[model samples]
Target: MARMTDPTNALRLFQHAFECGQIPVERGRIDPTLMFACDEPKGRTRFNYMRAEGRTLSALVMFVHSDMIEGHPCFNIGYAVAETFRGKGLAKSTLVAGLNEFTNGLNGACIPVIHIEAVIAPENFVSQQVATVIFDSTPVTITDRESGLPALHYMRRINLPMRRL
Candidate 1:
């Protein structure tokens, strides 16, 4: 698992996906190098390999590149699942794992992440559909005045430090 974080490994997988046209890199998006360069001080970036049946289904990234919101950091969940594994619930479930880590202590108490975001393009219907199920509320369209991008913004929040009656 530790080796997956290696820059070379990430580059290999990223290159494969890029060559297959599964991701948009030339359109000013992501570069494989970014996966290795996610460091501290400003924000955090992490790229995890999604494995199924001991085989890699996707390379998912959950990055807290932005500062915290209401004391909770906002990390964006981005993934590039292999084309062959598309239409299956792998991506949807992968998203659930991220949301769960924030809500529940699925990843343990040390990393009590609570808020996450997923910004999707208007035309990406597959992701739009997944976002609908992942978030409790409907996806919000960010207008030019409201935000920088015109993508659909989806967020999940869980108030931590629960009280007992």
Candidate 2:
């Protein structure tokens, strides 16, 4: 089941990013189904995914929070694909799909529009390119809250309140 297996991938991502926290392996597992809910029951929820074809690749997920950045919504994306999946347009397509879903470009009952604001680490060039080209985002220097480190903040605005059809 997703509950039993997702943590393995989550742990891989968490450890690989060096996010500076000790992953508690003994802790109760989180249910992956909760991610697709219309709304999160708790704060800081993110949608997670793996490629449908036997999941040889994982889609690093992005989350948009209603509460952030001076009381307005903002997106903080963090994702990683297996090394083998890199340079194959996977990340670009993933980002495009995500942006379209959030920006009323896709059909749905209610599309919640939230601007994506990615903070790329200084050395992460590929992601920077994705932000710049796909989202047409421009970056500015800022300090990352997680590590108090210098980073690039890429912002792409979107329609607000989403569109209800």
Query: Highest lDDT, which number?
Result: 1
Candidate 1, pairs of clashing residues: none
Off by over 4 Å in 2: 1-42, 69-72, 104-113, 160-165
TM-score of candidate 1 relative to the true fold: 0.58
lDDT of 2 by residue, 15-124 (tens): 44333423221211232211121223256665443332232334444554634554446666555555666788766665655554434322343534455677777787
How displaced is residue 79 in candidate 2, in Å? 2.6
Question: lDDT (CA) for every model shown?
Answer: 0.52, 0.51
lDDT of 1 by residue, 54-157 (tens): 22334343444444887766666565455666677766765555444434432444444567677776777887787776677777887423244467778877
